[model samples]
Target: MEIGKLPNDMLQNIILNKIKHFRNDILVRPGIGEDCCAIDFGEYSCVMSSDPITGASNEIGRLAVHVSCNDVATCGVEPLGLLVTILAPVYASEKEFDEIMGQICDTAASIGVDILGGHTEVTDAVNRFVITTTSVGKVLKDKLVVSSGANPGDDIIITKSAGIEGTAIIAHDREDFLLERLDAHDIERAKGFTGSLSVVKEGVIAGKLGASAMHDVTEGGILGAVWEVATASGLGAEIYRESIPVEDITQKICNIFDIDPLKLISSGCMLIACKNGNEMLKALEASGIKASRIGKMTEDKETFIISRGKKELVSQPGTDELYKAT
Candidate 1:
């Protein structure tokens, strides 16, 4: 009933419950936190993930690639190719279609991934253009990292800043409104957040460094990702609100909208579960990526957040706050 991702309980009850295992090649089955599905391929496994771009009008092509690739990266897989599907309204013009396809081609080329065949049709089924991409990557069986591998005592690290994607979407989609309240420089900086959407570099580094689990922050934001990671691991987590990074521009925009930056859509940021937080931090920093140890896994199965000297139960992620704005 939400605008973004489906709630956990409803998802399990309605969708995940209906799927039945019929194939033996599926190494990794569907789950809440697991971003990509893995298929057995002997020495190596094929990881695949698909997502659609339905939030913003600008930069849809770039967003589709990064978001789908980020999911495969969560499994320590380097994306090799993509299957893109475009659904545009009947009123869509030829120039607009060219722009979308051009973006998809250019973004895929820059990332060194091929654009495989997919369907494209203009129909009255939707009002605006929607692009969905299924990214494929490969990883050695022994090196595959999973979202359910987090254990007690493992430190939780988050890369980049909270609401990185949400800020960029709002800045670009609502440019006129943002210009009314935010400074021109701030709006420009927020718009630049799109360039930082890809996590392939840091993701590979973290996987090599032996991260127990990795999840890309998406629709529900950082806090939502934490809850999903802990749930998937059948464990608990203690998130320190103060340690989570939030850029000044993000905070300002969130303030203008009266929303929590932590509850917004965040594609650029990633949540990592590992044994040694310091080591992971060092490795990420050496690679020029900003990261912080914001929490640790708990022995008990109860998720909570430490904010302003008070501890409160962390709620399950619902519709992202960004939906209210977009």
Candidate 2:
């Protein structure tokens, strides 16, 4: 098995197949590309998502909150609260535990979300500290968005640049190694990429503007996200390779490791599908969020990435490139 997310096929065959949906109030259930689940709450739908921070050791608390909240935002809902669980190794110190809790508190405060309640304990079950966050949000039933809602002919828009999270993680966790081959200034800039790790604002804007679908770019990066959106919608996609934005620092770091920037993890980027892409782009610009229309959903059932007059079929995302670097 891979170190990151389960491959799409294994997830479908082993996990998704065994799960049964019994309640009528559940609007969304577990599925490929569907990060958040929405349950009917009368006039509103309560959205929730859970994610664990395991890839990086530096900012586990902060990343835990943002990653789960980003999943909730993918449904175009602003997260209101979080239930955080911490599992620390036996060798962990109280100071380290306090630091993690402080980060969780500070991050949740910054995002206007409350830390409701959760369990924390030090055990020998794991090697390092692992923080998992389950974020909760609410949205009107009529306005709820799902990753499978994308329609053919809708334009695909991406927010922010590629590999935003991976760049920051590698720069922070592998600073000593990077410092040997890269300039200090460049490494510092890459670490600063964490400042742009939230997609809640753009998610709300796109949702309010009637985006057909939205998927938060997480473990799989931009290309993997495009594949998920298309697969979940039962449609195909055509992405222009040159249109995907990549920061110079990110490129340099990836070049050092010989990894594909397109396949790297990108937490800050949001993948949106809408009928009026130009209007969506304008709205995002007005809000001061950088975005680009990289491609479109297609009637065909085969997804492809076109670059320099060549088309390459997109494969199901395997292990994330982040694992390789980390």
Candidate 3:
């Protein structure tokens, strides 16, 4: 019913409820906040996740790859392959299609992943161009991490800044409009946020450091991601609003668009639940990744964001702020 991801309630009641996991090999099945599914294969587990690129038209191919791979990385596995499907409108040109494929290939190569076979077609499908990518990875059974593994007393860590993906998308897609209110340099810097869109490095680092749980900040921003992690783990969280990092350009863009930065899509940022916050932060810093301990998991089943001496309950994430701005 929404432009972005389905509401968690409807997703559970209408979709997830209908699907049953019949095999014992399914280490991880479909569930709220569980982006990647894992299947047991003897000593190792296969991890996979699929996502579509629908928000920005400029870097759809790059977005398609990173989004799905980022999901797989939440399991702390390096993606090795991708299955891509491309559907283009009737008016789409050959050059455009070639560019999209080139981007996909270049990005996959950069991540050291192979481009598995997939379908491509030009039809009257109601779209400019839609690309869906399914990233595949593998990890030892003992090393696998899931989103529901978080427990009470665990510290919540956020990598990078909030609204990283949204800022890049808005900066690139709405460049002309943003030029009216912002300088060219600012817009250029915001667009460059795309370079930081991968969470695989931090994901692996956190996983290796024995993080309790990991979730990539995607359709929902930092707040939404925290809510999902808490709900999935049957726990609660207390997030310090001021501790959540947000880039100045991202904040300005969100302000101009009258949207909440905390509720925007942020694929580059990773949400980690860990028992040793300082250790994880130090590990991330050593890897040249910026991270912050923003909160802690609680036994109480109510998620709250405290700001300026006021505590407010965080609601279920709906449409991403990126939709409104774009």
Q: Rate the local accuracy (lDDT) of all candidates.
A: 0.92, 0.94, 0.93
Per-residue accuracy of model 2 over 1-326 as CA lDDT, tens digit each: 66989999999999999999899999999999898899999999999999999999998788988999999999999999999999999999989988989989988888899999988988899999999999999999999999999999999999999999999999999999999999999999999998889999999999999999999999889999999999999999999999999999999999999889999999999999999999999999999999999999998887899999999999889899998887
Is 2 or 3 the stronger prediction by lDDT? 2
Inter-residue clash pairs, candidate 3: none
lDDT of 1 at 306: 98
Q: Which candidate order results from sorting by TM-score in descending order?
A: 2, 3, 1
List model 3 lDDT by residue over 162-269, tens digit each. 999999999999999999999999999999998899998998898899989999999889989999999999999999999998999999999999989999999999
Worst 10 residues of 1 by lDDT: 1-10
* Cα-based RMSD of candidate 2: 0.7
Q: How far is 170's C-alpha from truth in model 3 (Å)? A: 0.4
lDDT for model 2, on a 0 to 1 scale? 0.94
lDDT tens digits, residue span 199-253, model 1: 8877888999999999999988999999999999999999999999999999999
List where candidate 3 sits over 4 angstroms from the true fold.
Answer: none
Clashes of 3: 0
Best by lDDT: 2
